[model samples]
Target: MISTEQLAGFRYVQDLQDQPAALAATLDSLEASPAPGDMADGIVRGRFRRVVLTGMGSSFHALGPLHLRLIESGIYSLLVETSELVHYLPALVAPDSLLVVVSQSGESVEVIRLLEAAAGTAPVVAVTNTPSSTLARESQFVVETRAGEEATVSTKTYVASLAALEWLGAVLTGAGVPPVLRVFRSACAGMTEYLSGWPAHVESLTRFLEGVDHIFLVGRGRSLASAGTGGLILKEAAHFPAEGMSSAAFRHGPLEMVRPGLLLCVFAGDLPTIGLNRRLAADVSRGGGKVAWIGNDADLDALRVGVSAVEALPLMEILPVQMISLVLAARAGREPGAFVRLAKVTTIE
Candidate 1:
């Protein structure tokens, strides 16, 4: 198990510890700014033919829940990476489409290119941390997340954007804001409670992850947000090799990769497919791979995350993965989230 001494003072760890406060501040910002009522009305009246969601890295993965919510509400939503959206699908940026872009830095190279390519053709709604950035200044609508400055990785900004996106989803779907605000408050409280025991969580994960050389995070439904972002952060922060995919996709081919050194972290996502996720965990364990089932009712205490609403699961589900990253970084004797080659913002496409 990693000692508290080794984990202390890392900027990424500090960022992780700041998530609850950042989340609260983001919620406060959302409450102060009213939802874009005109845009919501336009969507309901079919002023916009479709919603295009795009971002890069964690920002891109963070759109999972919103994309699903938009589709479930009967809106035609396309989830695309900004790089692809800019290079291959510029036609989707027509005036009839609503573009929802998530970027913590707001000024990534692809985002800059996208904004230039868009050239105000579509009404853009940006979920970003930088209020003065090009994305915020040029967007027709903006939801700024108060994640403050993140020195490394995407701990606070990613989660804060999730909160903002959740509120945006509620407004765009005409689901009302009060209920989503309540969920946000509950999720922030849960994050605080969980992070308070960070040391124990890290230690427990250190033991649970013994001899695991690779990881696969799998889930269905909204939990895909965590699975996707979880894989990204694990590699970024710990330099660990990990992959995230839908649970069903795992059964098709990657399931064959299961072996003694492999760790399968399965999210028992929303009830619609929780049974399948649970069965996948069992099968992976039976195949001699280490299995960590992540959910409120997870069999392992180290992997359990307290989830209140299914909507909040995406926010809560990431806590255990954060702990795993700390453990893996400690095992590797490296400072977690210290970027060796990458910059915080992608200046080059």
Candidate 2:
């Protein structure tokens, strides 16, 4: 059994707990702003030829939902990492383009270079927690997360940014801000309710994954936000190596690794692809693999975080992974959020 001493004085757990309040405050701020429909008229009449969404780390992964949101609305959109956008795809930042840059810290190494390399004509729509950041000051528009100061991993900021981006998407698509705003308004209570049982979540996951040597997180669509960000934090928090992949993409080759030492966690995404995701989990279990299914019906149900309403499910999906990181770090006799080398914000490109 792992000891609590292993994780004593760590700020990661507190950061995760603060997400509900942080997210609620963020949504509240956006809701009080000018109605989104009235604000997005410039983008609708083709004044902006395309949208480029760029960020790094969890910020990049959070773009999964927004990228799909734009495509669903018949808007031209490109999702690129900040580093790659400035270095490899400079052509995408043209006079007619709209760059929506998502970064918790507005001054990451890549974000600084993006400003340096930009054509200076693209209207930057900065979505960040830091209002006074370089990215926010230089942008034509700014959307603040208001997730407050985070000392460890990006628990509060990531979810807040996702909610803010969803608001941005709703505005661009003219989806009516009332419905989406209500969804996020309810998200505050839902998140607190789900996270109230954090100890139970940690115990359940730790017991189930006691002997697991490797883990894989799988999902599609909005759930990709969880799948990708979950894997990165696990490795960062616990120094554990895990892989996150699309549910369909995993079967291509990773299926061969379905065995006792490997744990395959699957997210039952939205209706269209959920059946296929469930089938993949079932097949892996039949092959003697350990599987944890996160959905409405499951052994380890993660839906308790937030019910599937609007875009809040993605916000909910990541909570369990945060708990998993805590338990994993405990098992390794290490402190959560203790970075041996990597800085909170990457300063070097």
Candidate 3:
């Protein structure tokens, strides 16, 4: 069993515990700063032909929900990684397009390169944790996540960015800020209630994860945010090999790899696809792989994240994966989220 002392020794765990407060602070910042009037007006007036969302790592994953929202609202939206956007798709940074860039540090190499390439051609909306970074200073509008300093692998910053992006999506889509704000507050409370049981969660996950050598996080819709980010953090924090992909995509090819010693954590996403996700989980189990269903109705208590609103589900879906990370770290006898080779910010390309 992982000891409380061991968990407390890592700054990463502390950051994980601090997420609810970071989320609350992000909501407060959103209320205080509001979306830029010109940007919102341009979006509503159709002055911009498209919206391009770009970021790296967890920041990129956090844009999944917003990208879908914009598309559903009939606004053309492009989701691209900052690196690929700078090197392969520079033309997308035209004045006719609006860019939404997310970065915790805001000074990562690709972000800096993109900012230089854009050169004020497009109106940039920056959703970042560092208020004073170049991405914030150079952008036409800024939504500060206010997640504070993260010691290593992203926890607070990722959720904070999600909150900020949700607010941004509501503003750009004219979806009414009051409702989104209410969801944000609810998500914060939900996160606190869920995280309050982290120790027990970790202990329970330790048993579920035993003898597991492979991990995959799969979901659809907004839950893609958690799946993608969860896979990234599992590797970064626990030095474990894992993959995150869409549920449909998994059945396409990766499903063949399912067998004993493999664990699949499936997110029962929004209502439209929850039934499909449940089917996928059942298939994985029948194929002899362990399945952890992440949802309110999960059979395993360790996997159940009690979320009220569908809007709040994405934020809560990630908690189970975080618990798994802790368990993986303890099994490997390493300090979770302690970097052996990576820095918090990527300075090199």
Q: Which stretches of candidate 3 lie over 4 Å from their true place?
A: none
Q: RMSD, each candidate, Å? A: 1.1, 1.8, 1.1
State each model's CA lDDT, in order. 0.91, 0.83, 0.90
Residues 245-318, model 2: lDDT tens digits: 89988999999999988888787777889889989988999998988787767656433444657487788778
Residues 70-188 of candidate 3 have per-residue lDDT tens digits of 99999999999999999999889899989999999999999999999787698889998898999999998889999888999989999999888988988888888888889889888
lDDT of 1 by residue, 61-94 (tens): 8999999999999999999999999999988989
Scored by lDDT, model 3 comes in at 0.90
Residue pairs with clashing backbones, model 1: none
The positional error of residue 39 in candidate 2, measured at the CA in angstroms, is 7.2
TM-score computed on alpha carbons, candidate 2:
0.95
Estimate the TM-score of every prediction. Answer: 0.98, 0.95, 0.98
Error of 1 at 110 (Å): 0.4
